[model samples]
Target: MSAFVAEPTTALEIESIGNGTGLWLPPEVRDEVERVQSGTSAAELTAGVVELRNLIGGSADLFHAAMLALMCGTMVEHGAEPGAAIDATLDLLVATLNTLAEDPDEMARAASRLSIPAAMTMLARSKETRKRWRARPEIMDRLEALEDADLAPFWLREVFTLHDDAPLLVLDPNNRRAFEFRLIGVRDRLYHCYALLQDALLRHTGPGYLGAEPVDPLAVRYARNDHLTPADYRAATTLGDHQRFAFAYPGIAFMPGSGTPAELPTVDGVPLLTVSPKTIHFNWRPANMYGVIHEALGSSIDLIRELSPADAEALLSRCALP
Candidate 1:
């Protein structure tokens, strides 16, 4: 009977929830605001107050600026000095917008609490605030000229590239230089965080999936088992076979009449066999593998299961071992 070795299959289930804010706010906040704005009576104003309270309840930053604006407008109507309150509310609004801009996740969370028109209104207001900050004529010319790709010393660039999603602040020199340096120190911590995230993801996937430590060269043996004889299996398990199974030993080959096998060579003796069985060899000067390890590892078995017979056969043929 012909030997049949089943290749291990992976079931990668990726569940991507709808995290996109898509430049829109919620409808409930919008509807209530509209109802309040339409009525002119004092009772309508009271109703508007109640609606605003409900709208801004869970959001401290959003609600604070909104309520402060309404209070300032009310104070102006009652002949009170509303300038200070308006200025404070404007500052708060600007701070909130800056926080949102620096963090896409925060922006997404805030978007869910607001309506599209409200978001637009807030953005417009923020643009006005940013204009005020710009009017001071204190700009970080060096930072402005620095390209995103060119921002760093080698180590810093590597850290930043690895943790692209981390928040970065380009500080004004006039501000507390020491505090800014401290923040920069925090940015240094992100490299460790990125490594931790990678490790966690790999562990979640399983051993050998991601951040597992590289195999120790000293610990690795040339032969997988004692069953492998001296010469019989050695010929079949050449440099090519060693490279392909560097991560894990490929099964030993048996001689026709020997009825036994030889020791598999250690990866050092045959570096070329470190190649994976999934690798597709190309004839190009610099050989290319058809699919990446991540793509192969992350493919859904369910999708494969649903594939038609012809399509499945074609896929198998395309990815056939060389």
Candidate 2:
């Protein structure tokens, strides 16, 4: 009998398994393309092509809803959905619409050709939310003066289709205030972390603890300790910029000027604990790094309080710093 023969797999064949198609771009490349294509300065044709590619290859329903909310001021104005995703999208739309309504420049641009009654009708019906959108008196006056016939259909469509949760008018005598209590709660937790980190760094950097704390413990226990010789202090201070680039730590989001110890002459006594979009600045002097860790632990504690004991324990265990 003749021996069976098998065809060899080429690189192209190997690449096809997870690639979805021969045309699929790698994730990193796709991300770069997305970043570039999002820019408005690109040629309309090129931008349209990129947008089409993104809609086809990198689609996310939440993202599409968000875009529609920003541009049209209402998710339902575009289309509708059901279930948890719909609810979440509506919430996001409300948030974004609220932001736009609050901004005078943006509101002006959006309502330039819209009439008050039409706008109010849109607000009332969209999202079925009844919150009033209030603006500065001057903007309101301008909106009130516009005639219905002069209004633009697109502008009216965008305005009326916003989520019901949007803040439309403070003119209503019975309007309730909308505040994000959760953000306040989070801020309190963050402040507690800062204080704990500050205290821990102060204690660890003192001469007594430095003499007795083992090197590993000293490093971990006093990871953020910034008190050192003048030369060492400078060196440690320099690490602030580099620490922002560290990938191992993901829980903390650093703000450029936030994490720095506030008392420095250069910083005008502001703490170096700024929160930025991508990073949290640990700008505290090296002597204060331990303090920051303590602060982080405190913040973690606050967060854990919101979870079940089992989940909290798991999170704490995972947060153990090396």
- Top model by TM-score, which number? 1
Report the error of model 2 at residue 167, Å.
Answer: 20
lDDT of 2 by residue, 1-322 (tens): 0010022223442344235453234467456545533534324323433333233212232222233222222221223211212323334433333434455343232322122222232243333232233233433333333323332222323232122221111000011111111110011122223333333332423433212222232232233232334454455444322222211122443323233222211112211222112233343433332223211111111111123445434433444321
In Å, residue 65's CA in model 2 sits off its true spot by 25
Report every candidate's CA lDDT.
0.26, 0.28
Candidate 1: tens digits of C-alpha lDDT, residues 91-178: 4444443344445353323422232223222222232332343322122232222224232112211111121212211111111110
Residue 183 in candidate 2, Cα distance off native in Å: 6.8
Point to the candidate with the largest lDDT: 2
